[model samples]
Target: MCVQAISNPRSEDDQEKAWQAVCPLVNQLRNYYEFSIALEAVVVDLLSVLCSDEMTSRQHLEMQQSLFKQFAEILDFTLKFDDLKMTNPAIQNDFSYYRRTLSRMRMAGGDDIDKDLDVNNDMANRMSLFYAHATPMLRMLSDNTTKFVSQNKDLPVENTTDCLSTMACICRVMIENPNYRSKFSSEETVLFCLRVMVGAIILYDHVHPVGAFAKSSGINIKSSIKVLRDEHPGKVEGLLNALR
Candidate 1:
């Protein structure tokens, strides 16, 4: 089902229909009680198709919008803020939801995030255009995930670790997309991306102990942070310190 639908969303109607079919599954998958690496991999692989470099500019833009809209559906399905998850003694199920969602978003925004090879001629423009469609959900999801992680201590290390990794990807995309770079200074997207990066670094260090954020995220978050440091050093001081 995912393979056929994501194979090529060439039209708006097809995109919407494709999301309608899968959004429920995505919602159900988000709140898994146990962290199954297999199911997570499957979700990542399917969403990667929409966010991959293997599409036309038009298709990319449509697919990004469709993906986020589907995310909003999942958000609507369950935005539980109560202590039910904590008291119920099922933090894994509750916390894994945010971890999974952020992981998926990071993967989706990833094509142009860190890979220099992904950019060629018209590719930068395509990513920037896709960003315009992608930023709202990206901003919302990252912020919510960060907030949730900060509040919950017993959640698995994977929840916080995955959140940081994904945020790094998002920051990388914001910095690299030249078409949208002009908006970097004043855009909420830029501010949120930086904040998320800082949070990710702190979380990574706390969770992994010896694991370095720069080496762990590899190119995606590192290059993205480099772009910010080169362009706006003062604004990114928090992110810089967190990396160190």
Candidate 2:
């Protein structure tokens, strides 16, 4: 309902209200791992609406902060969810069930099926792009989290350390897996992986006592770099840009 309101709002006030209502739920995604697939769909829907050209310049300016906040949350959730899914078979089961149900609904042409459950072409494209590059979103998250930690020095270093470590590990796993590396068919996706890997290394170096270069860091940085370099010889510009 909130998504519908935001997508087809009668007024600017209505859309803003819808977003306000939904933002809290989005912020709590880490607590709702079982529903990650469904929640991901919702997040993608909202992102597509916000990023679409249909939004006016005025709305873009008005919602700029909200948009960035949403992006950061999406990035964090995507990484965390990917990490969890790697360890938990249940997450894949949930996604399979979701796909089957959606397929059944389409096959039956059920009028009773909620339109919101349907993945429109635009939303599908957005979802693919999100999992592909998401560099812009990662940058937003990096900037916001840096600002936040600076403002809240009293925040536990352990919490920050764990978060950055998990992000780095996830990036390494995705890059090292041959199947996953094969999916990086686009330059954009390759660049996204490089950016996240480099960003994670830089941040983890700062937070981890021994630094990301340490063998005990558990990041397997050399192997991951080797995989990327061997698979994407033409991505030298991408790597250079990531370093920059």
Candidate 3:
């Protein structure tokens, strides 16, 4: 019924045996439908469940919160390409729901209004809700990757280049939420934004090594930022402009 119920691989021997038999047919379906389509479906379902108006009651909120926490734990477990390869449409739906839930939680936490500012102590408490709700999910995702590597054994801890993906996701958030920049004075908001930037920058550095991003992209950034200060005797200077 929940995303967590469907997202994990069956650990039982009989379940794995069943999946092993179905793997071939699943590959056939993969040929007809790209993996990304399936990924999107999963995201959509999870979002629907999370944002449903039916979950408005305080008691319902606590229940959903608990379930979300569990979903985060599931993410921590190792998820393999094979583990996700199943032929059962129903099972696949479940798995997709789980993955989508993780993505939704991650983005929502990062984009929370109260996360980046210090306007009030109450804001800090509100920001804590994001962390409290998300820590488990973060741990789950991390654990899932780790478990995947452990299971594969031969897989190396190679740097993964995810800059374009990160940038694109950030762009989507910025475009969708125009007020993000205006919350900079809020302590919770600033902390969250800084964390996102720092994490992204670190990932980029790890992937490209030797500051390739700075060398390749900094020039464009600087040129785009340049502005003319005067008209008669034009003085041009590059300045970091706020989007807000």
Candidate 4:
């Protein structure tokens, strides 16, 4: 499904075709382990598309919400599948990650707090453009998933250590130049990407901790952290010290 989305993407026809190819897999994802992990991959890809600075449009935001609603339904439904046995590490891990992510999204959307007009518009625009291009794939994923994650509460997090580390790196980058980070306002977008990266790294580290990141990337991370501290003392001294 992922390969098809990348290899043959141009028109709605292509998108729908690719979606159809993967739509049948949802029924096979009967287990919580399969469902949550797959859902995580889908959410990450969708977020990457929506968060990119290059594509900004209203259509993308609507699509993002549409995708979110679908996933939410899936997760919500899936939450009821099997017993809520916190003792099962797989179930626990998947549930935790889902809750954390959903909470983050809702918070970012300002569902609870009062919205800032400019910030909201910027976020909405970026998300919309992302969905315009990525929705078909997400739709395919939505079709494939059997369970839905609930939105009223937080997405779960089985392990937050790597997430914390990635966030630390992101803060370092943002403090260096919060004003010019991405297409959206420089400040929060950096934070948002940091959050995603952290979550991804956490998942990766869960599988391959020692080499989760390339040596080059690690060096870059180390160097970036140093530069941030040296050039932007106020931003880095307190915030990104843990990243290194």
Candidate 5:
């Protein structure tokens, strides 16, 4: 039965049916890290199916948002552990799969990867619901950085690095995609976006390359730090060093 669902999803209806059939199994197994690595990949691939551009309806995008929300919970489950060792290779592979699928989605649904995004539009509000749910997952990255550092335990620095790399890749896609950028003009979204970027910088190496996208993200992070100069100068400076 599971094989039928996973083997040949034929249409939008078929994909949705496959997801419905497979999703509950993913949720039930996600808690067992050692046993669920392959399950995670299969589930994330199903997510890519749901997010495909052929759906082409506002309602389909809403379904995509819900799917991402579910993925975020799975990520949270993966990170709920106290240390990174047990999670290392499985989590790394999961994130790598995520990067590939999201990049495909971005290119399929996005604009020129090298262009600057228009700041005037709301980006179909794909981001409107996504960031709200994804924020907690990003925060888990931030918290893990500090926790690992403070413990003086073996820091799986690469875990944070992989996440920032995945995020930077996604950020580049967003900044380059006009629809995605339109959502950033809202003050709340703008600030929240900078907070996550800056927090990652405080934790790891530079994940983005020389490009308009990276430059823009850098500018926003610097500006946000300046605004909070009086409130958290030390952490702000830490972010600056991370950027450098």
Candidate 6:
């Protein structure tokens, strides 16, 4: 219902209400492992809506803060979800089942297709843009989190550390897994991973007292770099650009 309301709001007020209603739900749902795929689909849809060019300038201005908050929430959930899925093999099985079901529904010309699981072309395009190197979402995450830490000096750094560590882990997993590396056929996907890996290292350095390069850092930076160097010898330019 919240998704429907957000997608086809009857009024500007209604749209705002829908976003307000769904933001917390998005945040909460990340903790539930069984709903990982559902949460992933919802995040993609919400991002497409949030990043749409159809909104008027005035509406965009009015909702700027809300948009940032939503993006932060989405980013947080994404990192947490990625971390969970890395440890749980069942998440992939669940996603495979969903794909099979969606495929069957498409083949049957069924009207009963699960709207939540099915991503339309437009949404997929927007999702692609979101992970691109030029994405505004990355800038937003950097700016918002920097400002947040500056203002909230009393807050614990553990959460931020965990987020960065999860990013590093994701980068490592992608580099180590041949199947995952094969999926990075697009330059954008490769750049996206490089950017995350680089950003994670830099931020992890700043946040962790001993730095991300320390022996006790837990993040295997040396091995990750070695794997990238050995496997992706051709992506040197992309890696340099990402580091820069």
How high is the CA lDDT of each candidate model?
A: 0.43, 0.49, 0.33, 0.37, 0.39, 0.49
Query: What digit string (tens of lDDT, one per residue) describes model 6 on residues 49-106?
Result: 4434555423443566465345445554444334343445433333333334345545
Off by over 4 Å in 6: 1-147, 231-234, 237-244
For each candidate, how many residue pairs have backbone atoms clashing (under 3 Å)?
0, 0, 16, 26, 1, 0
In candidate 1, how many Å is residue 113 off? 58
* TM value for model 1: 0.32
Of models 1 and 3, which has the larger lDDT? 1
Q: Using Cα atoms with residue i matched to residue i, what is each candidate's TM-score against the true structure? A: 0.32, 0.36, 0.22, 0.24, 0.26, 0.38
Better of 1 and 6 by lDDT: 6
Better of 1 and 4 by TM-score: 1
Against the true structure, candidate 6 reaches a TM-score of 0.38
Estimate, for each residue in 46-159, the C-alpha lDDT of model 1 and write its tens digit.
Answer: 334433445542454455766533432332222221112222323333223333433454487863533432232243333233223312222334344445445545555454
Q: Which candidate, 4 or 5, would have the higher TM-score against the true structure?
A: 5
User: Residue 186: error of model 5 in Å?
Assistant: 25
Error of 2 at 118 (Å): 46
Per-residue lDDT of 162 in model 5: 41
After TM-score superposition, the amount by which residue 164's alpha carbon in candidate 3 deviates from its true location, in angstroms, is 7.6
Ranking by lDDT: 6, 2, 1, 5, 4, 3
In terms of lDDT, which candidate is stronger, 2 or 5?
2
Q: What is the lDDT of residue 23 in candidate 1?
A: 45
Candidate 1 vs 2: which has more TM-score:
2
Off by over 4 Å in 5: 1-33, 55-61, 82-213, 216-244
**Candidate 6, position 207, lDDT:** 58
The model with the greater lDDT, 2 or 3, is 2
Best by TM-score: 6
